[model samples]
Target: MGPKIKQINRRLNELATEWNSFDLGPSRRETHSFVNSSDVIGRDKDKENIIDHLKEPSEDGNIPVIPIVGIGGLGKTTLVQLVYNDDRITELFPLKLWICVSEDFDLPRLLKLMILSVNKEENCDGLTVESLQTCLRSLLNDKKFLLVLDDVWNENRARWIELRDLLRSMDGLSQRRSL
Candidate 1:
């Protein structure tokens, strides 16, 4: 039989009031449908390589910064995503972050996304980009993280570099997983 549990020890029933509340959004299960792809077309060798990389976070005495570069519609995103979600990878790096820099790249939006992805239990509402940057710095300052920036396309590479800098400044055994 299961072990018996303990009891509560509260005296007064103090009720708390909500202030500037945010809606308890739907779970990922309900919001975004998981695209089943176990039977998805092949990439066995690539998957193996990613697993190996995760095993050895360093290459040539440096933390490997792998950039899966290729032109559009070449399955770059798909390949990266597959590796990102692979069971072996999921086991290796406990912390993972994925941000999509689509055709239209925006700083505030990207910051909000990074905050939400890492600090799932916290709210990012009303936080300015600068504030977000500060908070991101604090959150990632000493945490080993894997950040993925996907689908980048812009005439000016400056925008991409700006975001990359912020990511690079993050702490912990962090590495950027781009495609």
Candidate 2:
């Protein structure tokens, strides 16, 4: 009986260690839009293609959604960074906003990030969706803006439709650029 109790205790300790190992702690890592163009290799053609598409006026007059799809660590973000930093992009779109969506697709949070990008001094805490929408609309009221939603993991179509509808509702958002 004593030997059996000791074995059980040993297994419990092992299980405890396994559980501890599984905890990865809080994620502090985040992606930003800054990139070193010289260090980037072999993505020039892809970048140029995206730029060309961006330069072309939308025939249907709707927001263009350009998706750079690839598995993790395949330089999708890097390629986007290159495009974002291009001089042509700056000339084409007067306003550019980069938001790292990263798994959580909370609409208000996204709005807050956009507001922050435009106006760094804004206090977006505790703002309602309507307020955020009004604020965003005011900022982008009559401007051609480029918004990049990077590292998005949300696949829920309904949420996307809601966001799309919100953007479409805004006047002059017709000339918006999104990715």
Q: How well does each candidate superpose onto the true structure, as a TM-score?
A: 0.66, 0.87
TM-score of model 2 (CA atoms): 0.87
RMSD of 2: 3.1
Q: Over the stretch 1-179, how does candidate 1's per-residue lDDT look in tens digits?
A: 22322222121222112321444543221111123457558777886776676666443433356677777677666777777777776666566778776656778887988887789875778988789999888877766666676665555778767876776666543343333
What are the Cα lDDT values of the candidates?
A: 0.64, 0.86
Candidate 1: lDDT of 39? 57
Ten residues in sequence with the least summed lDDT for candidate 1 = 7-16
Q: Write the per-residue lDDT of candidate 2 for residues 76-97, one digit (tens) a residue.
A: 9899999999999988888999
True-vs-predicted CA distance for residue 90, candidate 1, Å? 1.5
lDDT minimum window of 10 residues, candidate 2? 24-33
Clashes within 3 Å, all models in order: 2, 0
